[model samples]
Target chain A: MVFVVVLLTTMLLCICIGSVNIPLKNTLTAMWNTLWGLELPAGVSKNIILNVRLPRVINVALVGAALSLCGAAMQGLLRNPLADGSTLGVSSGASLGAVISLAFGVSIPGLEYAGTMIMAMLFAFLSLLLILSLAYVLDRSMSTNSIILIGVIFSMFTSSAMNLIITFADDHARSIAFWTMGSLSGTNYTQSAILLGTLLICGGIILRYARELNAFAVGEDNARHIGVNVKLVKLVILITVSVMIGVCVSISGTISFVGLVMPHMTRMIVGPNHKRLLASSMFSGAIFLLLADLVARTLLSPIELSIGVVTSLVGAVAFIIIFYRTRKAR
Target chain B: MLKAENVTVRYGDHTIVDHLSFHLQEGQWLMLAGPNGAGKSTLIHAVSQGAPYTGSITLADKDIRRYKPAHLAQKIGVLAQKNNVGYSYTVEEVVGLGRYAHSRGFLAGKDDDGEARVENALALTGLTELRKSNVLTLSGGELQRTFLAQVFAQDPEILILDEPANHLDLVYQKHIFSLIHEWLKIPGRAVLSVVHDLSLAKKYGTHAVLMNNGKCVSQGNINDVLTPQNLQAVYDMDVYSWMREMLGQWE
Candidate 1:
């Protein structure tokens, strides 16, 4: 109940507080009028709320939920508390794809308008496949530790490749840097709808596996002994979370900390039960991102910070505190 | 009955468990005794129907492999030697997971009967007081008993345990063995355990298999197979005096 209230309250506040500080009453009135196709006293207010801020808020919320769900699932599947959506190198691979598209002017045949996003998603899947194949070759089985180690190596490779792209594009360096920093600008209602659709579909499937995930947390052999098909669950979770992370990165350009931070916070609050953790994380994630974006919009007033900057600042502090507590307790 | 014939477990070019055969009747307590690297644990893993192997195992006249994993779980419960959890699940939650095969949904939200089974298992294992405590804080003996409770909650026809008493103190070891013995009073229930203590094995084991270097050194009634000569041959040590000393302690 608290999560819902916080989410709805923050969502409304985000819609009202961008560059122009419209009062909450006017914000809701403008939204209702614009949505219902009724006349409004301030046409500009309607335009700003409907066109400029609504999609951004909705997009950030969707990305936040998707990333957090992905993080929780990844951590459960891998049996690592610190694992997140990027454990498979999705962010670095997507960044490399985005840089390639931006620097080389690459365009897909029918997706020229969405060439960068398409490329990002494509490379994210490709990097995941590479890591799986590498793990198979090295261990003759897809062990979780092997995949994590190979993903780290792939992340390093992609990061260097991104640097190479930046160095070559002297005039486009600033554009590439801004893209890597992450943003929620230029989203439309259609894009937000697509993200929402993905979140509902993927999140529902992940929730259905909550029992198997709980079994896995006890250890894979133990889960299998209790009747879970360990290999199949691992494969399904890996692919589903990778796809969710891929789509989220393509849309939001690597919002760094929502995935890693939200799940941990939700876990601390709800205990380690994945059934409760998955849902609470989604709600908390939406609230976190919406609030982060609101701060990004209002903190400097007209000089908007990247949403990623605000999230990382908060996430880094949380990470340090958690680390200290866990270490000291141990 | 649980039966295995010509079972062989191999890893790469090495044969961990050579062609082995055995049959366990219901209500029997079978003990597996062997020196290190004798493939006792490997044999247990292979017969549980999960590990890769070249073998044929049957439970109640049906091929073990043919049963769906969930259905197989209902018939056979395995208690592994080591239990390592990634998350700090409460003791109750860990024990409750044994009902996964019988559970209708993902969360193992047990019905009344299932909840009763969990409660009974917790009571049997003396873990009711620690039900809410995190498993990570449990002592070694407590953790062992917790896993035992999980296996008990499974309510399988057969229980395969590896080193069931390894971390337990003497009193709890006797307590757990007595519980297993009492559990065997139910019809169509059996236990297969790997034990290291000769005195305990002689007391609780009705049937026994002694192995060395992946080959069965002796197999028959527990008293017959655990003879001093067989123990000496397998362990490469003088066991006649040791056996007498152990038996004297029991007396």
Candidate 2:
């Protein structure tokens, strides 16, 4: 409840403090007018507040929530604190698919504009499958070390492949490079809607298994003894998290560390129960990213930094502090 | 009741539990005793459906594998020797997980029956004061008791324990063993435990199986199976003399 209020306030603040600063009253009036099909207020510009800032902030929040939620689920599923989309190479797989679509103009039959997103999502699932199968073949127990090692190797492989594609496609190289660095500048209502839909569906699936995830805290075999179908739950959660990471990456590019750091931070506050941890992590992630995006755009007045750069900077520091504090506490 | 016939567990040609058979009747507390590599734990794993075995293991006349995981869980509860808890869950929350099979649906609210069971389990294990405490902050004995309380809350017909009190102090071992003994007093309940301490096994077990090199050397009543001659064959030592000498030291 506290997180929800803070998140709402953060969103309003982010909307009001962009390149063209609008007063809080005007922002609220604009939002109210937009909500009830009324005309825009006299002082508010629809293009700046409604069209540009609203969708951008909403996309940031949705992507933030999706990434953090997936991270929490992955960490619980693998029983490894460091597990996330990047660790498992799913984000890289999505990036590869997006790059392929952009470089070669690949398009689905009817959904031409959604080519990158569809391809990215497909490849994300494929990457998770490939990595899991490889890990399984190497070690039947699928030990945490083996899976993480395989994921890191696969991530490196995909990154190299993405570099090769960028090199060959000269015309789209600049755009592809910018996309990989992550941005919310290009997000519109359509992309925001898509992100919102994916977050809801995937988040719902992850939340449904909170008990099973709690069962996993005692180890996989014990979870089985406690009646959790370990294999089925693992499959369901990994697939769902992969879908979420794919969608978030396709829309906002690879925003590193939000998935890895937000969950750990939230776990400290809410304890390790997924019932509360997941929801709290979503709100915290949203607020963190909204603030990060705010800094990225406004930190250097006219020269905008990539949102990814800002997040990596802030997330790395936050992660180190969290790590140090937890270790010290222990 | 539980029964195993010609059960063999293998890991890539190396047989861990070879052609082992045992029966656990209601009201009986069976103890599986062996040396370090004698496959006692593996046999427990096979019975609990954690490991695959070649032969049949049945609960209440039905093949164990034929039952769904949830249904089987409602019948057999296993307390493993070592539980790897990575996160910090409250003691009560961990105990409440034992009631998972009894509940329905993903978003189901807390059941009144489950809450009462959890409360009863906490009190039984003397963890009522620590119900809200983080499990990670517990001592070894307290942690063991927490898991024992979980299995108690499960209310399964057959309780399988692997070294239920491995590294605890004598007081904790006695408390836990007596709790299991008292639990077996209820009709239609049975227990199978793996124990390294021959003395504890002789004291608490109604039936015993002595194993060496994945093969059972003797199986019968506790006194019959734990004979000095059989102990000598498996342990390669004068079993009675060593225990007598240790007892003399205590005196």
Candidate 1, residues B164-189, lDDT tens digits: the string is 99799999999999999999899989
- The alpha-carbon root-mean-square deviation between model 2 and the true structure, to one decimal in Å, is 1.9
Q: TM-score (0 to 1) for chain A, all models?
A: 0.95, 0.94
How close to the true structure is residue A224 of candidate 2, measured as C-alpha lDDT? 89
Q: Which stretches of candidate 1 lie over 4 Å from their true place?
A: A108-113, B104-112, B243-251
In candidate 1, which residue pairs clash?
Answer: none
Colliding pairs, model 2:
none
TM-score of chain B of each: 0.94, 0.97
DockQ of each: 0.78, 0.80
Q: lDDT per residue, candidate 1, A2-30, as tens digits?
A: 98898888888888887787788888888
- Candidate 2 lDDT, tens digit per residue, A1-330? 899999999999999998889999998888898899999857687778888999999999999988898888888877778877688788999999999999999887876448888878888989989988998899776655777798899889999999999999999999889889899896889998888888888899899899888887657887889888777787788778888999898888889999999999999899999999889989999999999999999999899899999999999999999999989999
